[model samples]
Target: MHPSQSQSCTAFDGHRLIASGPLREVAAATKQAIDAGAKGPVLVFDDQTSLPVEIDFRGGVDDVLSRLGLASAAADAAPRGPGRPRLGVVAREVTLLPRHWEWLAAQAGGASATLRRLVEDARRGEQDRALRAGEALDRFMQAMAGDLPHYE
Candidate 1:
């Protein structure tokens, strides 16, 4: 996983949020703070997915990620030339009704190009999706941490 894809990790001190950023920095800082005798059970959460992620606070950031087989940061972003596929493109079959196919074919760029543009438009909605995911996570956290002193 790319470091950016890991999204943000938030470290909490007891019920209070202490640090928020990439997993590496958040983990290292949390470890340092804990080592300095901060009260912990420091919960680290993936901000985007709202899922819990573990960190070996005992190890350095690079050591941890390398051991886990995740890239530490954006490793490469080679530009795609004309007629070249972008990274992670997957070819799959789609079955549409005849009329649907006709509509797609009628599009200025035809089916494949129209589909690609549609996918790109959906990709642009990622931020809105993230916000919704965050909201869902907030509701979850509220329920999970409700009894704690600083739940919100």
Candidate 2:
């Protein structure tokens, strides 16, 4: 799935991971944890994007489920066609030294294909990068986010 289209979230109770899956599942799990009086705070983050997801389980399971269902149904209502969306590739000036351009020109598939390959390889390694970033964000929250109002 495209990163932008993903709704998968991971719920963390303090340093330990509680649940990782769809929004509804994570929210339910988080609710249970909160109701059971879990330690510290429960935070849910987008699995792929690493963005925070705020879930209000104060209204109980039905309210949370209804919200999740509405969100999914709204997304499903969007107009979509079979096959992947068009890859919006655009040309831009890339300034490179003479030898760099020469090497790219000498490659089997030329500069564009080489650039694409390089990007795909970097993207493939994003899971590790994202994990590091997520950890860093948690640390940041521990140090800096405490003073913020309504932190939990």
Most TM-score-accurate candidate: 1
The residue-by-residue lDDT of candidate 1 on 23-127, one tens digit each, is 656766676777777786677777766666766665665566565455554443454554424544345647578999999999998999999999999999998
* TM-score: model 2 vs. ground truth: 0.45
TM-score against truth, every candidate:
0.53, 0.45
lDDT of 2 by residue, 24-49 (tens): 66777787787888895677777655
Cα lDDT, model 2, residue 29: 76
**Candidate 1 clashing pairs?**
none
- List candidate 1 segments past 4 Å from native: 1-6, 59-113, 120-135, 149-152
